[model samples]
Target: MESTKDYRQLPNSSDHYCFGCSPLNPSGLQMNFFADQNTVISNVTIPDHLCGWSNIAHGGVLTTILDEIMSWAALHFIKRITMTRSMNIEFIKPVYIRNPLKAEGKVLEITGKHDAVMEGILYNDKGVACAKSTARFAIFSPKVAKRFGIADDNSLNFFANVFGIK
Candidate 1:
């Protein structure tokens, strides 16, 4: 099947250290996120080390990809820092190592100034849906951002760039 529409890759700060999207994480996924309007997307291949069964990708890893993409959707389109408050994932099929996979995330709704609902999906090489997820997030206001060390102007600017806040 055809792939997702071509999208622009988002930016990350020099000090960014996220396990999923950080280029600096030597052993992490180092996934790159791109945007399709309100959605965030990532295409990647699962490595052996991230697998569960002999050649099957771990559920945790798959879940992480979902969370990362959805969180990015919120951060980018919603322009807020959010944490997953609750989530449900259904694994439809086993994802094998070395298979090209795609993850997609979209903000379903903004429940409140500090709350949002989001959805995500995982597609295997042939574009069959292998997993699906939905989640609730708690967006951090400026006050909460301070407790997380993201209150500084520089840090906010960095996040704004990462999320494409114009």
Candidate 2:
């Protein structure tokens, strides 16, 4: 039975402990991403406790947000499991805490077998582009997924539903 879900999100797991995008992690960011065609988007509000300085969002957190959006983009948009290959980020402006931030990612190209290039950008509450990033990823094949122990029935089912693959 193919359960075709109308909406798409990065697949979740029971024990996912990712600080950037895990709903199960109590002290984590708990980011939720949505797909609009090939673009992956997430809205986040940086908390005061996550600041590096007096009121600025931590640079590591900002980079994590960028990495997450782009990684999720590769997952749902490419319909494949992947690992980030490399990332380059540029911070254009300081991000303040407790502000609505928008993170967006898109698939730039599929370079080779199970490999792709992706780009991401972060915008502040004032609609200013505060940061930008680009990266490459290694999408996994079935054999690789099995070897990595991430290819479970639940994940496959979730992917199938989101992608309408009967």
Candidate 3:
């Protein structure tokens, strides 16, 4: 698939040490993402140290990838801060370490103003789906998130700027 041209690269803050997308976390996945009309996507290769059995990528790490991608999808498309309320994952095939993979997330539906249903899928280099996830997220505006103290000032400001919140 095409990695650019049609897709816009999403930004990440240097202030937070997120295990999924942070640049400052030495042991983190350091994944980056791009956005198109319908979805947010990430391409990455699992490191050997993150393997569960032999060269197979761990289920939990894969879950983290799905969660992160889905969260970003909610943030980008819904223009809200999100927290995972529930999720279900299916392991369709094995994902090997050191092999390139793609993870994608998109909003399936928005329930009311506060909740969204998201879907995340992980694919191998050959484009075979290795795993899938569906999740419910509790979305919050930047102002509400800041008031609730769930997100710090740096993140709230970044979201506010990115989403053009007044």
Candidate that scores best on lDDT: 3
Off by over 4 Å in 2: 1-15, 150-157, 163-166
Error of 2 at 96 (Å): 0.9
Q: 1 or 2, which is superior by lDDT?
A: 1
The sequence of per-residue lDDT tens digits that candidate 3 reaches over residues 1-166 is 4365678998888888999999899888998889999999999888888999999999999999999999989888998889999999999999999999999999999997899999999999899999999999998877788899988887788887875533
lDDT of 1 by residue, 66-118 (tens): 99889888888888778899999999998998889888899999999889999
Candidate 3 all-Cα RMSD = 1.3
lDDT of each: 0.83, 0.81, 0.90
Q: Record all residue pairs in model 2 with backbone atoms less than 3 Å apart, i.e. clashing.
A: none
Best by TM-score: 3
Candidate 1, residue 110: lDDT: 94
Off by over 4 Å in 3: none
Which pairs, if any, clash in model 1?
none
Q: List the residue pairs that clash in candidate 3.
A: none
Q: In candidate 1, what residue range of length 10 has the lowest lDDT sum?
A: 157-166
lDDT of 2 at 74: 84
